[model samples]
Target chain A: MREYIYMDNAATTPVKDEVLEEMMPFFKEKYGNPSSIYSLGQTSKVAVEKAREQVAKSIAAKKEEIYFTAGGSESDNWAIKGIAYKNKKKGNHIITSKIEHHAVLHTCEYLEKDGFEVTYLNVDKDGIVDLEELKNSIKDTTILITIMTANNEIGTIEPIKEIGEIAKSKGIIFHTDAVQAMGNIKIDVNDMNIDLLSMSAHKVYGPKGIGALYVRKGIKLDSLITGGGQERNKRAGTENVPAIVGMGKAIELAYENLEEHNNKLISLRDNLIKKIEDSIDEIKLNGHRTKRLPGNVNFSFKYIEGESLLLSLDMVGIAGSSGSACTSGSLDPSHVLLGIGLDHEIAHGSLRLSLGDFNNEEEINYVVEELKKIVQKLRMMSPLYDKLEGEK
Target chain B: MYSKTVMEHFTNPRNVGEIENADGIGEVGNVKCGDIMRMYLKIEDNTIKDVKFKTFGCGSAIASSSMATELIKGKTIDEAMNLTNKAVADALDGLPPIKMHCSVLAEQAIKAALLDYSKKNNIHIEGLEDINFDDDLHDHDIEE
Candidate 1:
């Protein structure tokens, strides 16, 4: 069988073997509920507590501030809806950006239907939301300003510290969906003045279906999913012990090796950029060159379709994603790409190859070589390329 | 993963090039959704002797265009016009569930080319309904 190259790390990463090994005993040997009063249950409960403490330490946040949920979407929904509902009397106004993951955008849309006003901030060509625009959009009635720390598609890192400062000055709660940024980037919640932060374990080489929200002390919000008195009654559900344990281990490993992993990713990312640019023309880079995530690289070929390029790469055993993984089937160019001022042709022709823990120089080189050939072959068959070539 | 036939058609597409100074040209798709196909047909004596295409889109888009041309070349105009998107997908061993629309677009581009040919020759084609193209939304992306 041919070896396959898994390069779509931004979509999700495979859990570390060490993390998986640590989580296995919880799934089988200790299946008792954490809510139970028996000693077996107590064992599960203590394991959960240890996991929570480890999760908190990884992000430089306090143990009491972290609340485990399902994933990034839940964290986003809870953060947006919880704040909007709790502060309804304070103001019905909310603020976010156009290029955010649909988790945040759709949640904001839901709030809009419930009589809450929301301002969708626009980003520049580099997918960076204008600080001035975000500031001006804020009104006295604004209750929260939620922006994603790093865009999933283009990998542009937003000005979170400045945005947090602006929201703090206006006495508005600031929440950032740090799902993609959590493991790859260092986020100091206290230093950044972030009121609330969203994260997912899957994106950090952990288990899927496990994530948390960093709700700063003294923040009051109603729970969306109510059943038991778990998570301090802020979020109520039976804990996913195995996933949570795996998540905690993943977070610990990520922090312990953060600098090394980030440096390697950035090196691979920069090399991929240089390779593509050196061989191809009329290609535009999608995100902020320096402020973006170390592992993410998105680019738009002027006349070739992203799907075509992706499929071509797939044939060569190089797996990658075009646009966002969630919205690939919709036949619409990515809103993230469009929001960054890419034209329809370029936007639809975008490719995002995000690297992670297992990727090495050999895999990067092979993928880049295959990509060059695919782009060249596809461009030759492109009517748009023919027109552009004629003009030139 | 696609079937073997699909991969074959994708890698070594049958009708790969464009026909220059042909009897007619028909193009489908807009750049907005990132697919643009231009099919050039050389119809001689009421038979499609050569069918060629240039496509700018995804895997399904290229494979469908290839299948469409392979399915129609040397077939009579009537038989070619009767070809549907489902047949094109079958010819390429079936497109992915999400990308079946690319085959649909391929079938439309072929019919569109025939329509253009019929208009030029004053030979009324079967599916030529009252058609009005704005030339604004499509012309900028798809060219023949």
Candidate 2:
């Protein structure tokens, strides 16, 4: 048997047993079109509405406000473009942070081609968006402000409540891509003043290809997909019933076990961070210390390449990511690292290890030991390290 | 995404470290591109007596340099100069499509060392004239 340890939960997670069990019935026995009026169809419709209520209660949202979509990317696209096209007369301006996911950034870029002005606010060295810069950047013509609750690369948690308050005072619609933050932490849409929120099921140990967008009551937006008037005609398509059912069950379980899970993850994360710091030299930690996610630990070694390190770890049956999984294969380093004031070389040396409920102490120790050896070996072959040490 | 040979070379590299007071030295790539290779050579009687390299790059790049040095260690200056990036990549099974530039760096580093060797000994090597060492960075930039 191969002994493997997976530490890339932020990229995606394995579906839990409960979620899989909940989805099994919907796939085979209860498989029916939720839009149809037949008895078999009504059973699926009831299950879908019950899942909607479960999703809403998890986030303290009203059931009517939750709209399903494909995943985080789609939710982001619909929320941004929907608001942009529907409220073009009210304003042609948008405000977002530089460290947003490409889903949000690329959507804003697409909107810019149609005469919409966008202001990308810069983040601090720790990847926190500057509330002052955000407040100053807003104008009378600014119709939307979209920022992420937690960054996917460095795992920095933003001041979303404060940002939501600012946007609320100005009456501009506020949206947050909570794909990384949804089940890991407590979020109340009413308390956060969030007009629109995006979330994905895969990040929270549910099925992929399904997510939700929480649009505040009475909010108006143009539709992205048009079909048989599903999702109250706001998003039109056959409902992804099994995935939705899985998401609801997964989210319910995530919150139920959140306190115990967070405690376990925080201890494991800190142990990994401390062991690496103590064993390695000339390394810098990325992201905020206490303000980061419970399972996120990122670091950059001075005289090592991340890809080589990742390969070495993989050979030992340990899996980790060099950066955000989306941008890993590109020769260019992560933009999120560059946005946080790291130079190109340091950015190229970044490694992110995200834990999950399945991880244990033994796995964490094994990972740290393997990482120490890999960094040492890579630095031995590094010409820059050789030059720097020779000068000494 | 590397072949077994590439992984073997990367895991247990052939010739690593620097040659002190070496006859010639060559360095290629830059910090911005996240790849840099510094090669050292000790030549005797028109033959490469010893070769060593230190590289900072991805897995393929380190493997390429290791393979390139192995290919030129016992060969004459003329034979070493004939070494191409494809030859080095082929010796290692093959590199990924995106990582072929690593092989290019290996070829450039060898040429750079040979150029330095010719400059010090005042030898009129045939192909050394066309390779402008100062502008070699343009090759990596343009090829991509």
Candidate 3:
């Protein structure tokens, strides 16, 4: 069988063995509903509560503060809309960065249609949101500030702690979609003064369809889903017991070896970036050199489109992703890349190769070797590259 | 999503590169739209002797350009002029609905080249006057 190298961890991750093992009993033997009062149901309730506590502990949040949701998108929607609707009387203004995931951006756009004003702050070329612009965008009527902890495409880590402090000083509710940063970085909600935060399980090597929202105490927003009483009457639905158990174990394992995991990823990421930079000409690194996610390595190879490069990589058993319009099934490329001031052509050529716990030095070396050949091959077929070569 | 033929053409595209001092040259699409096809044709005795293309686009775009160049090679200029975007799409089995515009781009590129050929020779070809290469061929507009 041909060896496959999985590098698109930012997209999703394989569930860890330990997490799967912890969740096995919940699927079959302990299938009772957590809402039931009987012993078997009580066992499931206890397990759910334990997972909630595990999720809370990882982010330095109280056990009662964490509310389990379906996933990150739900958490994002719930946080943004819940705060907006409940506090409509207080304010109608929302502040967010232009580079936020569609979960946040689209939600803000939806709010805009309902007469809500949203300020999309601009970011620097390195994909970092300017604190000055962020501060300037804040208005007296700003009720909430929602920005991602780290970008999904570029992996640029935003100034969450500083942004949190600014929002706190301005008496505005601060929320961060930390789905990408949950396992990669250590987050202290208390220290950061974050009023709300979003996280996902699949990004941290847990099962999909399970996530949690951290709503700081004393901040009461409207309930997300309305149905039978569950999640303290905030989010209403039957709990996903096995997935919750998997998330609990996955998050615990992630935090348990956070330092080692980050170090390994950072090393591999840097090596890949350096090798690609040295080998390929006319390439631009997309995100900040240091103040970025440890696992992310995004670059734009000039004169070649991203989808072709991705196809070439896939043919060599290397899984990768791109910010091109063709890959996204849209007429425009990634908003994050465009937000960072990349023109359509450069943005179309962007490639994101995220590292993870499963990758090794040998895989990185192999990927770099394959990448050099692929870029060269694609460049030769490119009319843009042909023009440049002829000009030379 | 692309057909197997599209992938096959994209993998080993025929007639890649430029024709130096060619009789006609045509370029279509733009970098902003993330697709550009440049075709070079060598015409002699009103027949296309050879054709080559250089494209900077997605897999389907490259495949479309490759297939378009192959369809017109060794054919009369009038024959190449009659090639439609639908024929190019049909020849490749079929492209996804969204990517049908690539076939449109391929058709436009051929006409643009033939137009270039006519302008250079100062001779008019039937059905060539209607084409205006200046109009933007946005990827969203899929031609029938």
Candidate 3 whole-model C-alpha lDDT, 0 to 1: 0.93
lDDT of 1 by residue, A1-392 (tens): 45888889999999899999999999899988999999989889988988899889976789999999999999999999999999999999999999999999999999999999999999999999999998899888999999999999899999899998998899899999999998888889988999999999999889999999999998888788998899988899999999989988999889899999999999999998888888888899999999999999898888888877777887788888887321376656888988988777888888899999889889878877788888889888999888878899
Better of 1 and 2 by lDDT: 2
What is the Å distance of residue A119 in model 1 from its true position?
0.3
| DockQ of each two-chain model | 0.53, 0.56, 0.84
lDDT of 3 by residue, A1-392 (tens): 35899999999999988999999999899999999999999999999999999999999999999999999999999999999999999999999989999999999999999989999999999989899998888887999999899999899999899999999999999999999999999999999989999999999999999998999999989987999899999999999999999999999999999999999999999999999999999999999999899999999999999999998898889999999999998989999999999999999999999999999999999999999998999899888998787799
Off by over 4 Å in 2: A324-327, B132-144
**Candidate 1: deviation at residue A376, Å?**
0.8
For residues B39-61, could you state the per-residue lDDT of candidate 2 as single tens digits? 89999998999999999888888
> Per-residue lDDT for A69 in model 3?
94
lDDT of all predictions:
0.86, 0.89, 0.93
Task: Give the C-alpha miss distance for residue A284 in model 2, angstroms.
Answer: 0.7
Docking class of 1: medium
- Put the candidates in DockQ order, highest first: 3, 2, 1
lDDT of 2 by residue, A315-344 (tens): 899888875211265656788888999887
In candidate 2 chain A, what residue range of length 10 has the lowest lDDT sum? A323-332
TM-scores of the models, in the order given: 0.95, 0.96, 0.99
Candidate 1 structure quality by residue, lDDT tens digits, B69-142: 99999999999988988898877776666667677778888988998899899988876675433233322222
Top-DockQ candidate index: 3
Off-target runs (Cα >4 Å) in candidate 3 are B139-144
Provide C-alpha RMSD values for all models, in order: 3.3, 1.9, 1.0
